[model samples]
Target: MKIAIIGAGGVGGYFGAKLVKAGHDVHFIARGEHLKAIQNNGLVVKSILGDFRVANLRATEKITEIDQPDLIILGVKAWQIKEIREDIRKVLHKDTVILPLQNGVLAADELSEKIDKRNVLGGLCRIISKIESPGVIHHIGVTPTIVFGELDKSITERISGIDRIFKSAGIESTISEDIEADVWRKFILICVSGLLAVSETTYGELRETKETRQLMIGLLNEIFLLSKKAGVKIESDFVGKAVAFIDTFPPSSTSSLTRDVWDQKPSEIEYQNGSVVKMGEKHGIETPINKFVYSCILPRELKARGLR
Candidate 1:
């Protein structure tokens, strides 16, 4: 299959490298030094699973240079969705399928509204990865599953074909019958964890402290209730499982938001915790913990943008 990975950052770089290693026709769309490094030396992925290189892979900064791909992995940050959507539309034909691996629940819906719903797939990634440097991606966790499926829960031929490609490439993927629930399940943990970790400045700190850990559980409970009200039936022990997972992480481990805040880079807080806050208001649900977390980061976000 001719595959194109938009935003060759951590998620894209890691997954695309795997597919290319399996001898698939993969092209990466990137920019700046990352693009330069891939062009000069190929994309480097350093992981505990294994370290490998894709030397002959095709990469470009412009979308016009590539042909319509069988699959497009939308791995850009949530904030870049609008600009990337416009660029992606230029190369997408009727048969091209878009798999948005961004965080939160709105990405697929927003993209589907712009593109055809039949061509958009809802996906959620479970991995702890980041770009350590130009041309290099670092995988920090063991969970590497990418769950996705059709928005309407149909078992179509395209879903099977994509699943086959992912499996052949050594990726741990599942084609969910109800991808919406899958997306919300991940969101329940990510939104709460991202908020708490960013507010505390470190995941380890939050995990180690009894008070903070209890607060984390509380925030998660609120998110769970909100999800139920939204008509998504999550697993019964979802919060317990999520808490257990967080406890296993390194004490000093921080979320992508904390890293972005420290580096003064743009963040997805507006869509992460901020999204929860908005949902809470809409549903008449009181999300004090989430609200406080969002308030704590709002100033830092504004300062990063020079609005202070």
Candidate 2:
């Protein structure tokens, strides 16, 4: 398959490396020093599962330079989706599939608005990874996994074929019968990202303290109520499971959102917890915890963009 991986960050770089290693024709769309490093040194991924490199890779900053891609995986943030979709459209064919392995729930919707909805898939990824340096990706922890499916929750030939493509690369992939529920399940896990950023708390800090743990639960409960009101199906008892999952994390583990805020880089503050708050307002639900978290980060987020 001829694949295009946009945004060669942690998520994109790691997954694209896997595809290229599997002997697929992959085009990496990236910019800055990262793109230069890849063009010179190839793409390197250090995974707990295994480490590998794709030498002499096909990489370009211009998406138009690549020929038609059978599949396009968006590894960019949700906020950058609209901006990148124009370039993505230039290289897509009629049956080209677009998968967004972003942090928030809204990436697919954002892409579908400008690009063809028929080509966009509801997708999310579970991976603890980061760009260790230019052209080098580090999968520090977690069993990297990809979950995706059609928006309408129907299983089809294309879904199975896409699942096969990822699995063939030794990626743990799933085709969900309830992709909505699956997406929300991951959202439940990510709700702690804002709290961790604001408090600079680690997983050990949040899980070990009764008060902090309960506060984390409160933020999650607000999201649960909002999801229920919005008519998105999530496992009824998933909250308890989510809390347990956090307990399993390493003591110093933090989220991508927390790291971005700490680095004063642009983050998904508006798309993650902020998305929950917006959905709450739309459904006449009071998301006090999420609202508080969103408000706490708004100043920093605004300042990050020079909006202050």
Number of the top lDDT candidate: 2
Candidate 2 local lDDT, 1-308, one digit each (tens): 78999988889999999988888889999999999999999988998888888899989998888788989998887789878888888888999999998877888888887888999899999987888899999887788899999998999898899888899999999999888788888887897999998888987897788888888999988888788887888878878988888887778778888899999988988888999888888899898888898999999999999898
List lDDT for all candidates, in order. 0.84, 0.88
Q: Record all residue pairs in model 1 with backbone atoms less than 3 Å apart, i.e. clashing.
A: 204-251
| Span of ten consecutive residues with least summed lDDT in model 1 | 192-201
Task: Enumerate residue pairs that collide in model 2.
Answer: none
Alpha-carbon deviation at 271 in model 1, angstroms: 1.0
Instruction: Return the TM-score for candidate 1, rounded to 2 decimals.
Output: 0.96
